[model samples]
Target: MIDQSLIDLWHGFGVAFQFHNLMWSFFGVLVGNLIGVLPGMGAMSAMSMLLPLTYVMNPVSAILMLAGIFYGSQYGGAIGAILLNLPCHPPHAVTCIDGYPLTKRGKGGTALGITMISSFFAASVGIIVMIFASPLLVQIAFKFGPAELFSIMLVGLIAGGTMSRGAPIKGVSMTVLGLILGMVGTDVNSGVQRFTFGFPDLADNLEIVALALGLFGVAEFLLNVNRMGAVGSNMKLGMKDMRPSRAELKTAFWPMVRGTLMGMLFGAMPGTGPTITTFLSYSVEKKISKNPRSFGTGNIAGVAAPEAASHSKTQVDFIPTMSLGIPGDPVMALILGALLIQGIQPGPQLITEHADIFWGLIASFWIGNILLIILNVPLIGVWVKMLRVPYKYLFPLAMVFICVGVFTTQNSLFRVGEVAVFGILGAILLLLKFPVSPILLGYVLGPMLEENFRRALLISDGSLQVFVATPISATFIGISCLLILLQLLFWLRNLMRARKVRESAGVPT
Candidate 1:
């Protein structure tokens, strides 16, 4: 299989570098980055909006363009999150927890450099895995029944619950709150309207862009309104500022490796996307760190891990999308539609039947990634120059962009209003010392988690044992339990130490 893939890849490089195809890849990557930079603009939106233009091209060129749009956007999303404390995409929300803080410390260029390096490394790892292990990953994804999927999501939620610095319960409660808010849309099973109090727009569920922007962007806007001068005060854009130190590079290496592996796994799965993988990466980095408390602060590892994971996941998304012909989400659905329109069938025989198309797309990944590296590095200076602009003037421009971006999501004023509401909610949570990110994780994962959980139960005739019935599911469940146990032990040890200190001090015991 490996030998055959090598032959196919060589042939693919031939087809992908055809002048027109190569140009499209560059164009796609450039457009993708632009889409990512704009708040609320996703690759799905960009592709859908631009897909009409692709209809005139041959199928392979179209696929290459769309594929570039899909993953290349991730490269730019980190820039917004790290530079402006605005997460243009949900996966980028995790980047903000540390990436933004690094920017605040005049390390924005270094952080961006790290994000680019980590993203490229992880994406290369993912692409290599796809080349070598696409078949294996597709099989693994099939093994994940709804029960396994539910178990994995549970692990993510549990890990996210413990992600905050001082307050696990606060994180957990925010997660629950997010889950509850996630339930606001109509229940898919019963078609019953939920939490949407006579407003028709709620039936489709909360927009992730609105929720994320509200929490990170608008909430920060409100909190820092008084301290406007402090925002981006440290954005010094020297050549040296853009490069990571030896110590920082060393710290980032392992997390990037771990995140790349995690991203590869999640990316290959149909239902589990970049958002979950990035969230899990953040948690894993925090867990493995000697000083976990430094995570929410400006830890370079935090930036490295999740950025690697998100970009890696984006690259790996190609596996299931191309191999299984399964569109894990709406973005891939469009690609699948493009395939059908091109009169190509998607199945296990995809690579064998359409070697040119498959191989060409793979080759485009390599080219697109190269293009992105060339495209983004110079932009670092431009983004840094923007930082020289004062926050007071900058934020209003951000607000206009946010409003325009959200409004474009569904062409509704209602969505823009939703951002304001969530902004207020996020502000309240922030002011009260609750970590708002777990809520976004819950909100992002909740609906999918509930759907899979219900589907798993339904498959087992409502038997709860189904979750642990399979070895795969059981292993995931065990991992989740182990993580919880570790957290419990940590908490208990802290409790005991605190009690001893209080007793010795003669305070109320």
Candidate 2:
């Protein structure tokens, strides 16, 4: 099987590793980095903008280029989070805790270097796991029924809430809001409008591209503009102040290893992504540290851990998406959609029938990860210099690209307006300090959750006990309960400690 797969992969490589394919991949990485450095522009938006170009290219090369961008953005997001206090995307949020401090302490080069190195190592691990585990994973996927899928989704929702920063209630509320937003289109079962409100276009429901771009990109631009004067006055780093010391490298090493393992495990699960992996990694590191008090105060481990996890998960997310045809996140879903469009079916037979695609895609991940490391290391100084560019001038150009990109999607002005509306909503959410990552996760998983849930119920004749009766479903729910209970216990312990501290200080409880 391995020998035959390699032979087919080499044939696919003839298409994916061509001069044109290499050029496209390079172009994709460059563009992806730029978008990643800019706050609010994520991989999804970048892919959406570039989707039209797919029409003119071969399917294999198109996917190769898109894959380059996908991983490249993970590399680029670290740059912004380190230099500025701003995160380019949700997964990079943890980077801001330590990355910005490193830059402020004049070690921006060190932070970028460690991130690059860790990303390469973690990505390589993820790819190797993919190569070895794909066959077994495909076999196991055959055992998942509707009840198992529904239970998995339930675990995802609960885990998402528990992993958030604030009250789980707030996180749960945001997820509920996302579910409502997801339900805005025509009812698939009844063929009647659900929340279209008399508009024909809306009957199809909200476009993912429009919602994502508006919420993250447009809203971020507005928020930045409001703080433009303050941002403009900050000093840019000189090249001499950028490099890290051997001590910093030693400090970052273990955290990177821990984060990579954490990310790989979570990323293998369907409906999870780098955003959750990063958060979980950071929280775990903070909990286990000898000097937990220094976590948000320029800890090098803080920067390295999340950066490693974020990029590592990007590679590992393919495990479930490829073998099970169950997306680990929104971007994977889009890739799955692309596969379906090309008449390539996904699931167990996918590896058997499309060995070339599977192996070549795995190979390209290694290539792309190496390229990102090579490209990002030398460009830290260049990225830091971009901070010197005024937002007044920069934002308008971003808006222009956004407008042109949205218009090109469906060649409709209405979509542009939709983007603007979402942008406002995104801006408001940012101001309110509501987490945006869960909302995206919610939107991506909502429809699938509802569909699987109903199917499971129908099969069981509305018996909820079926969820507990299935072994896989029972295991997942059990794990979910344990996680929630553990979180609650931790919270209560923290509260008790706080009260003790207050009492010792002679303050009222």
Report per-prediction Cα RMSD to one decimal: 1.6, 4.8
Instruction: Give the Cα lDDT of each candidate.
Output: 0.86, 0.73
Model 1: colliding residue pairs: none
lDDT of 2 by residue, 444-504 (tens): 5677778888888989999999889978999988977887887789789989999999999
- The C-alpha stretches of model 1 lying farther than 4 A from their native spots are 228-230
Candidate 2, superposed: residue stretches over 4 Å from native:
1-21, 35-63, 77-111, 162-172, 195-255, 258-310, 316-358, 401-437, 486-509
TM-score of every candidate relative to the true structure: 0.97, 0.75
Instruction: Mark the 10 consecutive residues where model 2 has the least summed lDDT.
Output: 227-236
lDDT tens digits by residue: candidate 1, 1-509: 88988998899999999999998888889999988887667776788788888768888989998888877788878888988888888889999999988888778888998998898898888878878988888988888889999999999999998897777888899889989989998899999999999999999988888999999999988887766564565567665677888998999999998988888888878967678888999998898888999998899999999998887887788788877877766777888898888889888899889998988988888889889988877777777777676668877888888898888878899999999999999899888888999999899789989999999989999999998899988998999999989878988999999999999999998
RMSD of 2: 4.8
